[model samples]
Target: MLLRRGILWLTLCLPLYGETVAGRWHAAVKTPSGEEAYFDLEVNHSGGEWQGMLINGRDRNVSSAGSFDGRKLRLEFNYWDGRLEADFENGELRGAFTRQSRKQVLARPFRARRTPLVSPASAPSVDAGGEWILDVGEGGGKEMWLASFEQDGARLQGVLIPVSGDYGMHTGFVDGNRILLTHFDGIRATILDARISDGRLVGTLKGSVSAMVTGRRPDKAGRQELNSSSLTTMKNPREAFRFSYPDLEGRVVSSTDARFRGKAVVVSISGSWCPNCHDEAVVLRMLYDRYHAKGLEIVALGFEYTGEKERDLRQLRLFAEKYKLPYPVLLAGTTENAQQTLGQLRNFRVYPTTLFIGKDGLVRRIHAGFEGPSTGARYAALQQEMTQWVESLLAE
Candidate 1:
């Protein structure tokens, strides 16, 4: 009788001791404003190893690795320095998603439940083809987003282009009139849930934040225009851009330092907290590797979200180490004080505003914002243009 009781207990607790969180989980993250953003996560165990993939819209990002020790589960999304730590109970996962590189350890509440994969034969079919203009937000804070979608049977693919930047490629499936799409780029995850009614797309946009979205095909509309010029007014253009800030080691570095003198410099106004800045950093690293010996010098002035200097510097150090950046990243100020910190420039609009200075120390161009990889051809074109411009500067 005692042996039988012990055997029964072991059998009952076996799943708790093992990786029971394997398989598909339907997740919904609640935004601070009480809106819910949904996603699908597929976890697998093979050869004594655990793997996880986050499926949003249509983008699938495989986790670098994951671990499940009974009740506690941890997943790492290496591409964006993100982590999900949670607890499993009654087939439900509840925890937080964090950007591990940040100093403050900001976390968003995340929850998921086990779900079975729907068979293709039983899946609902809908067509999601054509261009759409999405009106996002409400009241006086509305914004417009342009989207292009293509569908084949149940498979759906599309891109959402917002004024700030594109949301990359999203892939998912359409079941009847209800449509779900998602995109995850390491640092951020976006989910769109909508239904087709009267040939209009009505949905909820859930990403870094949540918003109600309504989209429609226009009778006649051209591609949205982008502001092309980078030159911003400065109180004095002839005067060299100047600043003195400490690096991660508390070493005060000045713009007028000998290392930057006579070099065609790229001064990047960036932040460790910005995803667009991350994309720009990758490009800058490539440019530095290619042109550093040819008189190019890149310096980043970081205006971090964390106001605490020590924490902010720690975040910057992590960012630098992660990307293996070769340039100096100096502490400028917090995001709130950015306008004042970079007061010398006229109308500095974004986190990744860049200033190109010729060897003569005159500001040549001030490119505001970045058109990341999601823009596809636009990103390639920008790379070509910047490379040519850098080459010209080197020759001069």
Candidate 2:
């Protein structure tokens, strides 16, 4: 009789349990400078499990694997092994977003409230909705960025494009003369707090790395900086490109394998943490599927942040699984050791540097980086250009 009563009581409270995690969240992580880097999430409880999504500028990456056992919640951002765990407390959820490697566990304090209303700013003092130049770092460490923005009323959406690639999108609001933008995509977070003085935008970029950033209107000379696609090249262009690395199963896959002989091949140098590399993977899979039967092949040499073999392989596998890639992705080395990993390559300035090798086994074309869909024309142009490149190589 007592057991029956407990079962009936639990059934009555099931709807209340569902209400605990069924709303949108405004999540924040504390940066090193003590500023909150923000992102949004929307979670739903269905089929007796909790599913959520990490909301970035133009991406809603869904967490298909997670659980909520009444009071505790865990969400897995499996695309890159980003995880979030929290507990219900005082009408809010408190937790830590974490990433793991064999050597360390990196965690950041996290807290979230309900998604709040979007209020327009009092008065917009400047239109941050066009092309500009953002310079980050100083001296040899400096990189020039192409800032493209879109403004509607007081809300602002923008992206910073560098010669290497873009950092995706940043969304914020313009209040008076100051503009604040924040982004948290599970693995990394960024807070851009800047104010307009005269005609220049000056601010500090805070997150994993802190630096002062400056922006200005670009002149004709500054516009020429974007033409950098052909700069990276091989130390010996006449020599055929070759590499040997281990796949996930410890099988050494080499460029000189019989399978690639007399066939057009594409070699991709990418990393686990690179957003641009992730974008390039999708197009690669489509091309492989379309032309694999017509003597075309592709391979990705993954250089990762962590040097531990297990952790790096896991990330590489997850990246491959996300795009359902059929090609062999091999572990090359840590990002810092890329020069040693690819001895013949020079001027490697980006995470994703694609090499187009003709049937003669010599690399004929190289693209420095890839910009995703958010960059509009550049993204479309790369896809079209590469498709034609692949066709020409196969034709040869």
Model 2 residue runs over 4 Å out of place are: 1-16, 101-103, 115-121, 220-228
TM-score of every model versus the real structure:
0.78, 0.89
| lDDT of every model, 2 decimals | 0.75, 0.81
Backbone atom clashes (below 3 Å) for every candidate: 6, 0
Which 10-residue span in candidate 2 carries the lowest summed lDDT? 220-229
Each candidate's root-mean-square deviation in Å?
4.5, 3.7
Candidate 2 C-alpha lDDT tens digits along 81-172: 67888887555779988876335677888888785424345788977777778888778987777777788888887777777676667778
* Model 1 C-alpha lDDT per residue in residues 214-289, reported as the tens digit of each score: 9888668654544534435577888988989998788999988999888899888888767677778889999999
What value does the lDDT take at residue 347 in candidate 1? 73
Between which residue pairs do clashes occur in model 1? 56-182, 57-171, 57-181, 57-182, 58-171, 124-176
Give residue 97's lDDT in candidate 2 (0 to 100): 84
| CA shift of 32, model 2, Å | 2.5
